[model samples]
Target: MLARAINYAQNQRSYMENYLLDGRCSISNNAAERAVKSYVMVNFLFHDTVKGAKASAIVYTLAETAKANGLNIRLYLETVMTKMLDYKNEPDSILEELMPWSEAMQKSCGLNNGTI
Candidate 1:
């Protein structure tokens, strides 16, 4: 076991060195682990069907992205769903305006926009 550990360390020496040289590198993946915990916990709820799981993953990703971008997740999703109907027959390019990171969405759904 000790020899295996040393061999693994040796193989990863360059990565370890990069971590030490990069001040911006995190020592642990706790943040990413925590981020995925929610998805894992709710996974069973969607596991019954592949389509359900895929839908859940898409919605969850959008919610997380909205949160990360400082947009009110609820408002962003609500606005997007409401506005999407208007562009249902339009080209897909029109949907870009509804993205969480888009200027219009940032202005309307941003946490600092006082709408929350």
Candidate 2:
């Protein structure tokens, strides 16, 4: 069963073959692969279940994006979790407050503060 599955996967080649059919499609997922390389390298970071792995990926994305945008990751997540409950039901107005580039979000998360 294992050998058959491996053979089938190699024959499928969908992971790389898609690049031939679509110019916009990536030739390689090197960026995404590199993004998870560190997490995967740390043995303790591996999750045994798909659900936990997905959850970890989501958290990692949030942290990385927050840090990249000059927001305090801890504060950004805390504010997002709390405000999501209040604004999630509202209209697009939440976008103004939740977006990392938005003035409101920057101010709220102290991204605009005179500190790195």
Candidate 3:
């Protein structure tokens, strides 16, 4: 059992190391994974207040969404919020502008490195 476990771990490590050869691959998903898991656990603490729970969930969603797209939350939110004012009357336009994978949003968030 011990030998099998060790072998499995070694296999996984070797697999992950190969990703380093790919220029865009990230060595670390730990931070991002932990952040998401932490939110899931933390949500239980705010379950008492419906309004607060909803608000917290939205913030968590926004934070995770921004992080997923290689965005700096503060900068992304600032830029998006400001730009959103111009398109408030046009919901569809605002939706396109706020998409994490959109070209304009990628540029605004400094994620123009050929990524989504």
Displacement of the residue 33 alpha carbon in candidate 3, Å:
8.3
**Best-fitting candidate, scored by TM-score:** 1
Against the true structure, what is each candidate's TM-score? 0.66, 0.59, 0.54
Clashes of each: 0, 0, 0
Stretches of candidate 3 exceeding 4 Å from the true structure:
1-35, 111-116
**Best-to-worst lDDT order:** 1, 2, 3
lDDT by residue (tens digit), candidate 3, 1-116: 99999999888996869868888767887776777787778665858888878877777777677878887777777777787788778858558768766777677775545433
**Candidate 1, 22-94: lDDT as tens digits:** 7976888677678768787878565888887777778877888798789999999999889988999999998
Cα lDDT computed for each candidate against the true fold:
0.86, 0.76, 0.74
Error of 3 at 84 (Å): 2.9
Give the TM-score comparing model 2 with the true structure, all chains together.
0.59
